[model samples]
Every structure is written in C-alpha cells, then in structure tokens.
Target chain A: MIKRKRRIETFSFFDHTGICKHLEKMAVKGWMIERLTNFGWIYRRIEPKNIKFEISYYPKASEFDPEPSDDQKTFHEFCAHTGWKLACTCAQLQIFYNELENPIPIETEPTLEVQTIHASAKKSFIPAYILLLILSVLQCFFLVSGLLGDPIDTLSNTAKLFSTVCFFILLIICTVELCCYFSWYGKAKRRQSKVSFINRQAHLFYRKLSLLL
Target chain B: MPRAKFQTLTEQMFYILLCLKDECYGLDILDKVPSMTAGRVNVGSGTLYNLLEQFLDAQIIRETKVEGRRRTYILTEKGKDMLKKEYERINAQVTDYKNIFEKEEIV
Candidate 1:
C-alpha cells in the first residue's frame, strides 16, 4: 500500500484559514500533512481521525534558512505548551495541528494576526506578484504594438500569437490577485472578521486556468 | 487613523501583563491566564508569543532568565505602570456606572 501521497494545492498565500480547513479535511481521510516541498504538499498515511489545524505566518522566516531559527523554535515551544504540534513549514507559513478537542487557538488577536499576514505577504508574494504584473503588462503592450506596426507579420507568427495569449492571461491573473489582496487588506483593517476573505469563484477559476496552463 | 501603540490593553494583553507580574517561564503563562480567569478567558499560544515579543521591544517586559529554549519573563516598571493605568481606567468606568445607577436606586 502506498503510504505517502503528494498533490499540489494552490491556495493563496494569505489564505491560511482556507488551508487549515483543507488540511483538516485531508486528515479525516487518513492522510496527515508531512511537509510542503518544491514538488507539492506531501501527506503521510495515518489512521483516519479528526484533528484541528491552524496556520500562522512569521515574516522574518525565509525559505533559505537551513533550519528553524531560535525565535521560530521558541514560538513552536509556546504552541506545544497548548498542545499544538508543528506539522510542517513552507517558508514563512507555519502549520500546526492539535489532537486535543478543545485546545486554545494559537492566534486570538485578529488585528495582530492580520498584521503578521500582511507582513509575510509583503516579504514574499506581494513583491513577486507585482513584478509579474509589470512584466505581463509590458509584454502585452509590445505584442499590441507589433500587431499595429505589422499586422501580417504578427498574425502569421504562431509563436508570437501564443506568447501574446499567454501574456494576456498572466496579466489578468496578476490584476485579479492584486485587487483581491488589497480589497481583503482594506476590509481586514476595518474589521478583523474580514480576514477570512475566501473568493471561492476566483479560486475555482484560477484552478481551472492553472490546469489549462 | 492607526491606533496608538499600546494605548489601551486588550483583554489578552491585560491578562498577559498580569501573569508577568511574577517572574515565570514564558510558556507557563499559557496555563496561568485561563486558570486565573476561571476558563472565561484564554490566550492563544501564538497570541502570547507575539505579545511577548512586542512587550520586549517596547521595554514593557524584561527577560529574567533563559535555560535553553525555556525562558522566563517579568513585567518591567513600564509594563507595571501600563497595567495599573488600565486597571484605573476600568475602575473609573465601574465607578461611573455606580454613580449614575446606584444613586438612582438610593433616590
């Protein structure tokens, strides 16, 4: 019997709540998340049981770190005191699980939680997504200019047409992601209840789009 | 406008500072707050960890001892003063309530 499985789950970087719910669902089916890797999320087969999951972001953490830093270790120790065991970490994202039924949560202050998430996003995804948005916009502009400058040459080149389409798709994705993040950030700042801003339609659309790409 | 830094302590922050009154291992506060509040209030481990870091940065709490991963902390003078101020603020609210409602009862 296969004891391990790996699958790519494209959750937004800031969707820790969504990720926790998904992981909890996976645990009920007998697969426990072992670690997150460049390949995908690896799950180890376990006895089918219910477990609670929580995720937190540490902005100072980096993927390049050889091992957990002293501060991260201390944070984990504190969580462990409340029965939260560290499950895995992917860069700044930390996943923890608690077998106890009524364990106190790891994050109680919503404002602080949002700030930490925003800081982590800035450190990683925010900049990368912004750069991708810029590159896609430039590519689309050049493609359009070429089309206008020489319609025949631009239309006849299959590679050019394909690249143009890809750049357009990239542009759309980048724009949607940035807009969604900023909107969520704005709402979260006003009220922490808005922290769990899961755009299911957009998420589904992205999943289908990724499969196509 | 953004909230002023630590101007008013939230419930969790108040309890955290209350726990720090006695030098105790950082993790011990996890159990202390809930017990102190009769399980009415609970501090999440992540919340405690982050608050401790912020308090240290603000010089509200000072690390007293470290034994490998286990470290102890105590409220600094600044922290104590802040806690006292919060206590007085809450007391004033209660006093105001009594002044209005209790006087009506006597009348």
Candidate 2:
C-alpha cells in the first residue's frame, strides 16, 4: 500500500531554509517527498531512515521545458558524481537528496549561493509580481469605470464580484510573497556574509560603517 | 568590476583553479580538492558547478574536452595570472605574520 499525505505549503516561497529542514525531518521519520507542488508537498511512507536534503537554485532551469536541458542534465550528472541524487525539481529550484552519513552540502560558497538564489528568484518571482500589479490596476480601473458608468450592472454581476474578490486575494498573496522573498533574502545575505568565500572588502566596509554609526 | 576582486581567489576558488591547472574533469575536482586540502575544505557540488560557470563566463577557465559524460576544463591565461597573484598575496600574509610574531617573541 502506498500511503500518502498532502501538506499545504504556500509559505515555502517565504522560507527556503525552513522548508528544506522540514522536508529533512520528514525524511528522517520515513516519509519521503513524492511530489512537491505549489499546492503542497505529497509524501509517501517508507522504511524509517534518515536522509539529507539540499536545495539549490539553477538559474538556467525552466519548468516549461519538455525535458531537462543539456546543461541541466550535465549539472545533475556532476552532482550525482559527487554523491547528491536529484530528488525533485520545481522550476528553477532543484532539490537533491543523499542517504550518506555525512555528505557535503551542495552549496559551499555562501555569497555565491545567496546570489544564485536571488537571481533565480528575480527571474521567476519578480515577473509574477509585475503581472499581478498590471492585473490589479486593470481590474480596479474596470471596477471604478463600471461603477461610474453603471452601478447596477457592475454590482449585480456575481461573476465579476467573485473575480474581484479573487483578484484582491491574489494581490494580497503576491504582495506577501514578494515581501517574504526580499525579507528572507535580506536575512540570508547577512547569514551568508559570515561564511562568505569572498567579498571581504564589502564586509569590512559594512563593519566599519556600523561601528561609525 | 574592480581590479582587486580579480587579484585574489577565495579558498574554494583557489583550490578549484589549482585543480584545473592541469585540465581536470569537473567530478575529479570534487575528490581532488578534499585531498589537496587534507579534508579541510570540501567544495560542495553546487558551489563547484556555479564557480565553473562563473569562471567560464569570466574567461578564467576554458572548456577543454568532453569525454563520455564528463566535461574537462583548464585554467586560461587570465586564470593562471589570478592564481599566481593569489599565491603571492597568501605568501605575503604568511611572511607578515612570521615577521610580526617572530620579532615580538625575540623582543
């Protein structure tokens, strides 16, 4: 029997570390992630064991591609050669898993890793925000014009009312998601600076400025 | 881009470029770096991959060969120069440390 569970996880966008850690804990308890989607993570029960999970951003990857591109395949092969097994992929975000006792985490250069994630987020998330902004502005324009032109028709239409509510809901979600992404990046950048492989001058500058203040 | 960032290499990058000095496969660097650093520095797969792309973009490294699912690369002239500069910078730091500590101990 293949037992499965769906966990609603919209907040994964807000918290990358939290989501990866949560998935690792789940894997520890014998539930392996069978499917990861915008809807939620679907897990299947397995023999109880520990597994290591790593999340990485591949700027070149795309969800619409019928197959993983040559570059993506080469990347996966290289990772497998180094012991990380590709667990799943959602758009630009790729997750790898290892059952080894102590596997090297795939992202060693902290500043580079943060920058990679930021670049990927900019490509995927920022566009959605722009689209949402345009749609909301258009919707509001239509709503206002409709009310001014004919109040009864605009208010009486149930479909438009429902869509307006949904548009607002989506707008709220877009705003929150964008905010969370930048906030998470802000914190992640600060954390990465500690273990950064480069950018010592920038770090020194920041320290000196903070001291001066 | 400033000239200084090009003048030095991070530990991860130094080892990476060092291993690629003789035209090595990408996977080989993962194993070679740990041994070279005596298990002190482990270049994670993602980091290595990204750095390779960045190096290629920056023309520090050039793809040399593609053999049966492996891609081999070697440091370019620019990469060699960067490595040499980084070596000198590290040596200078060590020299400065020895001078300061040894002189203080003598005093």
Candidate 3:
C-alpha cells in the first residue's frame, strides 16, 4: 500500500489561506502534508482526522539555512506552547499544524499579517516575477524585431511563431501577477483583506500546455 | 500609509504590552495574555513574535536579556505611553455608552 503521495497543486506564495484550506481538506482524507518540494507537495498517510493547518512567514529565513536560526526556533517554541507544532518549512514559509480543537490562530493581527506577507513576497515572489517579466519582454522584443526585419522568414517558420506566442503569454501572466500584487498591497494597507495573488492553477496549466505545444 | 506606526494598538497588542510591563520572557507572553484576560484574549505565537520585532523597531520594546533563544523583553516608555492612550480611548468609548444609555434609563 502506498504510504506517501505527491501532488502538484499551484498555490500562490501569498495565498496562505487557500493553502491552509486545501491542506485541511487533504487531512480529512487521511493524508497530511509532510513537505513542500520542487516536485510537489508531499503528503503522508495518517489516521483520518480533522486538523488545522497554518502558514506563517519569516522574511529572514533562507533556503540555504542548515537549520532553524535562533529566532526561528524561538518563534517555533512560542507556537508550540499554544498547540501549534511545526509541520514543515520552505524558505520563508513555515507550515504548522494543530490537533487541538479550536486552537488559537497563528496570526491574530490582520494588519501585521498583511505586512509579513508583503515582506515575504518581496523577498521571493517579487524578484522572480520581475526576472520573468524582463525575460518575456526581451524575448518579445527580439521576436518582433525579427518579424519586422524579415517577415517572410519569421512568419514561415513555425518554431518562431510558437516561441512568439509562448513568450507573449508569459508576458501577460507576469504583468497580471505584478499588477495584482501591487494593487492588493495598496488596498491591504487601508483595510484588512485575505492575502491572495489570484489562483495560479489555470495560469500554470496554460503555461504547461504552451510548453508542450 | 501603514497607519503611522503604532497610533492604535489592537487588543492583542495591548495585552502583549501589558505582559511586558515587567521584564518577561518572550515566549511567556503567549501564555500570560490569555490568563490575564481570563481566556477572553489570546495572542497567537506568530503574532507575538512579529509584534515584538516591530515594537523593537519602533523603540517601543527593548530586549532585556537573551539566554540563547529564550530572550526577555520589557515595555519601553513609548510602549507604556501607547498602552495608556489605548486604555483612555477604550475608556472614552465606555463612558460614551454610559452617558447615552444612562440618560435613556432616566427617561
């Protein structure tokens, strides 16, 4: 019998609420989140139970850390005191689980939570998006210039046209993601709102489909 | 843009400052809050951790001791001042409620 499972579900880095909800649903099916990896989210089979999942961000955490830093350990200790135990961590994102019924939430202050999310997002999400956006723009510019320079050659080659379409889709995705982040950050300051960068499942599916094409 | 840094304190923040009035361990705030409020208020550990950092940045709280990861903190004068202001603001709301409702009772 299989004891572990891995699934690729695209949950945006900022979408902790969404991730937590999904994990809870998984927990009820006797599979608990064990780790997050480049390949997928790993789950280990467990006795079916209702458990709560929480995500917290530590902007200073890095993937290169050999172990939890002193401050991170301290933070974990505090959470443990209230029934929230460390489940796993991926870079700045720490996932915690509590078996206690109605455990106190890991984040009580919405404003502070939003600030932490933004700080974490700036560390990873923003830079990646910026790099992807630059890449897409450069590729688009080169393709357009090539078409203008030699319309017959560019149009006739199926590969160039496909590359152009893929890069155009990438550019749109990057632009929308960056714009959504900024807009959400701006509104988050004025009022409390759930942190989300839009569901990326469909976007990811399209990207994969484009890659295959 | 982010509320001018500690202009108002949330209930959790208020309780955290109350816990730090005397030198206290950072993790102790997690338990102290709920008991102090008779379990009416609880500070999430993550919230407490981040708030401590933010309070330190704003000079509202200062580290008193560090026994490895078990650090101690105490509310600074600024933190005390903010707590007092929040107390007064809450008090004023209660006073307004009594002023209106008490008069209505007489009528």
The parts of candidate 1 lying over 4 Å away from their true place are none
Q: After superposition, how far is residue A29 of candidate 1 from its true place, in Å?
A: 1.0
DockQ of each: 0.71, 0.50, 0.72
Q: Pick the candidate with the highest TM-score.
A: 1
**Fnat by candidate, in order:** 0.74, 0.72, 0.83
* Alpha carbon deviation, residue A129, candidate 3 (Å): 0.2
Write the residue-wise lDDT of candidate 3 on B10-104 in tens digits: 78888999999999998888889888989999888899999999899999999999887888999999888989999999999999999999999
True contacts kept of 1: 0.74
Clashes per model (N, Cα, C within 3 A): 0, 0, 0
lDDT of 2 by residue, A103-175 (tens): 8888887778888888887887778787996797678678889989999999999898878866766665566
lDDT of 3 by residue, A1-213 (tens): 789999977666666777888899999999999989988899999998999999999999988899999888988998999899999999999999999999999898888888898898889889989999999899889888987899898889999788878888888778876786787787777767555545457655654554455
Assign candidate 3 its CAPRI class. medium
TM-score of chain A of each: 0.93, 0.80, 0.87
Q: Which has the higher lDDT value, candidate number 1 or candidate number 3?
A: 1
TM-score of each: 0.94, 0.86, 0.89
Off by over 4 Å in 2: A145-153, A190-213, B1-7
